[model samples]
Target: MRVRVLRVLDVGGLPRVFWWVWVSTLVARTGAFVAPFLSYYLTRSLGHSAAFAGFVAALNAGGAAVSAVVGGVLADRVGRRGTLLGALVASAVTLVALGSVHSVGLIAVLAFLAGLANNATRPATGAIIADIVPSGDRGRAYALNYWAINLGFAVAMLSAGAVASHGYSLLFMGDAIANVGCAVVVFFTVPETRPTSVGVAGAGHAGQPERAGTLVDVLRDRIFLGFLGAVLVGAVIYSQAQTVQPIMMGQDGLGPGAYGAVAALNGILIGVLQLPMTSWMRRYTHGSVLAASSFLMGAGFAVPLLISAVGHPMGVYAGSVVVWTIAEIGSTPPQMALGADLAPAHLRGRYQGMSTLAWSVAGIVGPLVGGWALTAIGASAVLWASLLLGAAGVPAWVMLDRRSRTRVATLRAAEAHWEPVLSAIASPEVVSAGVPTSEPEPEPV
Candidate 1:
C-alpha cells in the first residue's frame, strides 16, 4: 500500500530541526557501533572472561538507565537542544576516556559513564521531535530518524570489525571522533524546544522559559504509566542484542566479525524497511501492532538457539538474524511512537525519559541474567530467557491496549464533566516549569 508523504513542518522552520535530528541520529549511532565490541575487546584483548565482561557491560547499562531519566527531567526543565548537546559532548568525552583506560575496573566505570551519557539524550531527542513536528507527521519523522540511526549503526558495526582487525584501539578512537563531530553539529543546528503550558515544551517559543512539571503530576497519569510498562518489557528483550548475543555466539565459535555482521544485518533491515513497515502498521491499532511485533521479536531471539559451533552453527544464527530483523522492524519504531503518543502534550520529555529509564534498567539486568545462564547452564538457556520475557509481554501489552483505548473514550467524558473546572485552571495561567499551571476548575455560570 502506498502511503502519502506526511509533512512534519506545519509550524515552519522545522526543516533544520529534522536535518539536525537526522545527522545526530547518524553520528550517535556510529559511535554506538563500538558498544557491541566492548566486551570482545575486554575479554580478548585485556584477557577478561565472559562473566567479567558481562559485569562491566552491566555497569554501563546501569549508568545509561539512570542518566536517561535524569536527561528527560533536565530536558523538560532546561530545553531539548541544550540537553542533547550536553549529552552528546559528555558521551564523546567518556568514549575517548574509555580508550585511554587499561585497567579493568577503570574501564567498567568509564563504560557506565559513557552509557549514561549516551542514553541521556534519548528523551531530549524525542521531546525535540515532538516539539517541532506536527502530530500527524511525527510517526514518519520518527521512522526516518530510526532509519538514519540503524543505517549509521550498520556502517559502524561493519567498520568496527575492519578497524578492530587493525587494532581495537582504532575502533574506539573512531567512535569518539564521530561522536564529537556529531555533537558539534547538534550544538549549532538543533534548536532548543521549551516546555509549553500543555506539557509540550517549546511548542511556540523556542527560547521561552517554562516551569517543569512535578514527577508526581507526570506519574499519576495512568495512561503514561501503562505505556511505560509496555516499553520496559520490550526493552528487556532488545538489550540482548547488544550485550548477550556476542557472548553467546563466542561460546558457539562465532567471532566478533560474524557477530558484527549480524548486527549489520539487523541495521540494514531497520534502516531500509522500518519506515515502510511503520507506514503499514500505523493504520492498525497501536496495541495490536505492539503485540504482534513483540511476538516477532521474541521469535527472532529464540531462533538463535539452534546454532552451537562457529562457522554458522547449523545456519540457525544467520537465519535468526533475519527473523530478529523482521521482529525489530515490527517492534522498535512503534514503541517509540507509542511512548510519544501517551505523553501529555507538555510532558513528552518526562515520559520519554521514563521509557528510556526502563530500557536502561533492562540493559543493565538482561546481560546479567544472560551471562549467568551462559556461565551456569548454556546458550540455550539464554534463548529460553528471551522467549520467556517475550511471552511475558503479551499480558501487559493486552492490558495497555485496553487501557489506551479506554483513555481515549474517557477523555470525552471527562472533558464534558469538567468543562467548567478546566476553564478555571487555565484562567490566569499558573505556569510552572513552563508547563501549564494545571487543569482548570469548572467555570461558574
Candidate 2:
C-alpha cells in the first residue's frame, strides 16, 4: 500500500506539480487582485456610482462568459500550456493599456478584455492538470490547485489594497508586474499536455472510440447537462458574495483591514485544511459530496442576514465564512474531478472549458444581481435573495445526484460489455507465451 502511494506521487511529484500550479495561480490571481476594490475604486476614486460598478462588473462577466467557451475550444486545439501562456501575456498587455486609459468607455472595454484573459486561464490550467494526473489522485490535485489560486489571490488582494491606498497607478503597476511574472514562469516551466488525438491513438485504448464526439455531443449528454445546471445556480449565489459581502460588511462598520483579514482567513483555511478534507471525503461519490457542500455554501451565505448590529456583523460574517469555507473545501475538488470525468479522452479541454464558462455565467450575474437588490430594496434584500437562490439550488443538487448515479451505471455497463472480449484477448496472449491461461473443464449439463 505504501509503495502504491509512493508510486503515484512519484509519477508527478507533489512538490513539482505544486510549484507549477502555485506559481501559475499566483500570477493569474494577482492580476485579479487589480480589481479588489474596483467597485469602490471606480465609485469613490474615479467618481462613479453603485450602478456603474455593476455595469463594469457585468461587462467583465460577459467577457468571461464568452471567453470560457472560446478558451475551451482553443485549449482543445492549441494545447493547455500555450493557451495559458497566451492568456497571461494578453492579460499583462491589456492591463498596461488599461493603466494608460482615462475614459470610462475605454476602461470598460479594457476591463472586459482583461476579464477575457483572466477567465480563460482557469480551463487551460485545469485541463493541463487533468492530462498529467491519474484519475484517483485528481481530488487531491484539484484541492491543491484551488489552494494555490486562493492563496495567490489572498496575497495579491492584500497587496492591491495597500497599493491602492497609495494610488491606482501603483495598483495597476503591481497587477501588470504579477501577470508578466506569471507568463514568464508558465513559458519556462510548464510542458504542453500531449495532443489528445495523437496520445489516444497511440495508446489504442478501448476508450478511444468514445473520444470521437464533438463539443455539442458531449454537452448534450443528459447526465452531464443536469450536473451543469446544478452548478450554474450554485455558482450564481456563491459568486454574489464576493461583491455583496464587502458592501454589506462595509455598511456594518468594518474597514479595509477587517475585510482583508476575513479574506486572509478564507485563504488560510483552504491552504491548511483542503488536503485533509479531500483525504477524508474520498469515499463519497463526487456528486453526493458536491451537492451537500453546495447546500452548505448556500446556507452559509444566508447566515449574514440575521445580523442587525453594524458593529457586530463582522463577527457574524466571519463565523458564517468559516462554514462556507469548509463547504468550499469539500465541494470544489469533487466538482473539478467530476467535470474532467464528463469528457472522454479527447474532449477534456473543451469540457473543462465549459465548466469555466458555467462559473463565468455566475460571475456575470452574481454581482449585478447583488447591486440591483441593494438598489431596489436594501443591502439586506441581497442576502434574502441569496437565500432564495440557494434554496433553489437544493433541487438542482438532487438532480445532480441522480445524474451522477446514472453516469456511473452507464460507465459500468460499458465496461462490463467489453470485459469478455478483453479477457479472450488476454487469454490468447497468455497461451502464446506458454503460460497457463486459466482453462476450466466443461461440466456435464
lDDT of 2 by residue, 1-445 (tens): 8877654433234435435656667666765656666677678878887888778877777888877887777777666766778887887788778767769899899889988887788788887676555556667788777877787777776667677778887777777778778877766556555334223331224554423435786567777777777778778777865778877778878887788688778888887787667777877777668767877887788788778755367788898788788878887778888887565535666788788888887777677777787778996676776667666766776677666665545543443444343333223232234222233221111
Q: Could you give candidate 1's per-residue lDDT for residues 1-445 as a string of tens digits?
A: 1222432212222344576678878876776656778888888998989988878877887888888778887777666666788888888788888878998778888988988888888998887776555444566677778788778877776677678889888877888788778877775565445434333222223334433355676679877787777777777787788767777778677787888677667766676677667667667766787787777777778887655454456367778778777777766666776677666545667878888888777766666666677788877777887787777777777778787765544433422333233233223332112232333211111
Task: Please list the residue runs of candidate 1 whose C-alpha ends up more than 4 Å from where it truly belongs after superposition.
Answer: 1-16, 44-52, 103-106, 165-169, 197-211, 242-261, 304-313, 373-389, 406-445
Candidate 2 wrong stretches, greater than 4 Å: 1-19, 40-53, 165-167, 194-198, 202-213, 250-260, 308-312, 374-395, 405-445
> For model 2, what is the alpha-carbon lDDT of residue 392?
71
Error of 2 at 359 (Å): 1.4
Q: Which candidate ranks first by TM-score, i.e. highest?
A: 2
Each candidate: RMSD: 7.8, 9.8
